[model samples]
Target: MTAILSVSDLTVAYGGVTAIDGVSLSVDDGEIVTVLGANGAGKTTLLLAIMGAVPASRGRIALRGTDVSRSRAHHRLAQGLVLVPEGRQVLVSLTVEENLLLGAHLRRDRQAVRNEIAAIYERFPNLGQRRHTAAATLSGGEQQMVAIGRAMVARPQVLMLDEPSLGLSPLFVSKVFDLIEEMNRSGLTIVLVEQNTGKALSVAHSATVLELGKVAIAGPSEALRNDHRLLEAYLGGAADIADEPSSMRANSQ
Candidate 1:
């Protein structure tokens, strides 16, 4: 099967420093591909580049056989690629329903937009119950739900989530992972950029470990779980990849 989304030899730099260096990865249709790394490892940069939120210094990005390397952010979204950024970046001043409405602003079909929002509400009944509430007043987990709901309204085929489980209570973290699994089971392809290593690997079909902007280790999730070097160097119990000695962070090539 062809990749629903793929990036090759992608490079991104911030003037004096490169955030990601010649990194490449792909997500097949309906598969969950997790990008794991510590802070400053360029995991988020990879997602931003793929979503067209940032420029790629060099590389090719393909979506379903079409090269989208030159596409703008909105155009990529139109191609069914959506990024729910980190930190649950909801418009805190807006009502829950209003925030969700913004996701469908690009769509012309009135009924379909309504139907999508309704489905989102059904999936997250808390949002349904408080649809009129201002986003600022919601709990962190609830706000995260709103963020995911907003993305769902866009009807993404390849939904890339940056830290869906970040900063939530234990209960919410579990719920967020469950939702990830549920969405994948419902036929949505996902590229998960997460710091919660163990949970991320548990639900992901495959995993890629990024260290200092390069892919350190990547393979099927099950196989990666048994990889002690990976677990010790990156997937240790921390919210981010564990800082290891120079030898530990060495390339797995």
Candidate 2:
């Protein structure tokens, strides 16, 4: 499979501290690649670096084989590389629809944008029901859906999500994971940084566990999932129990 997104020996530093050190991973076209780690392990930093939100002190980043190491965040977004940041960074004062519209600001086809937003509403009926409601009034999970929708409007070929399930209720978390599986099934490539290690593993085709700013283990998701000791030793948080069997089946079949 051709890699849609690739990072080689990437490193990022904050002042004197190196956030991501010599990390490398690849997300194949239409495959879900997961990044898992404990706090301060630089999981979020890896996603930001890949999206060009943070400068890489060393190493290279490529999207669909095109080098984008020095590109700006907006430029990366225009290249179909998008990031749904860790905290649902929605414009609180804006209505749900308005916030989603912001994602297509760079798009020239107003009609296409409208169509895309409609598709987003179709996927998240709750958002459709509250399209006119202020984003601040929505629940945490709703805000997360809005954030993901906004990224979707940008027409991302590779979507990188940072700790998507953080601080959500179990009900919402399940919904979010289901949405992820549904999107991946439709041929969207995803690089997911998730705290729910078990869910992440089951959804991903491959996974890389970051440890203290470097890759501790990287392999097929099934291989890692079965190695419970390796996961428990390196995975930063408690793994959730839910496993979407269909997602795993997609890989084995």
Number of colliding residue pairs in each model: 0, 0
Give the per-residue lDDT of model 1 (tens digit) for 1-253.
Answer: 6689889999999998988899989889999999987777898889999999999999999999899999999999999999999887999999999999988978899899889888888888989999999999999889988899889888899999998877677788878888999999999999998776778878999998888888888899888766756577664444334322212232321
Regions of model 2 farther than 4 Å from truth:
236-253
Cα error, candidate 2, residue 202 (Å): 1.0
Return the TM-score for candidate 1, rounded to 2 decimals: 0.92
Model 2 vs. true fold: TM: 0.93
Task: List the global CA lDDT of all models.
Answer: 0.85, 0.86
Q: Predicted candidate 1: what Cα RMSD to the true structure?
A: 5.2
Q: Candidate 1, 111: how far from true, in Å?
A: 1.2
Regions of model 1 farther than 4 Å from truth: 235-253
lDDT of 2 by residue, 1-253 (tens): 9998889999999999999999999889999999988767898888888888788999999998999998998999999998999887999999999999999988999999999899989888999999999999999889999999999998999999887887777788888889999999999999998767778888999999889999998999999888877876886324433242322222110
Output the number of the TM-score-best candidate: 2
Task: For model 2, give the 10-residue run with minimal summed lDDT.
Answer: 244-253
Poorest 10 consecutive residues by lDDT, candidate 1:
244-253
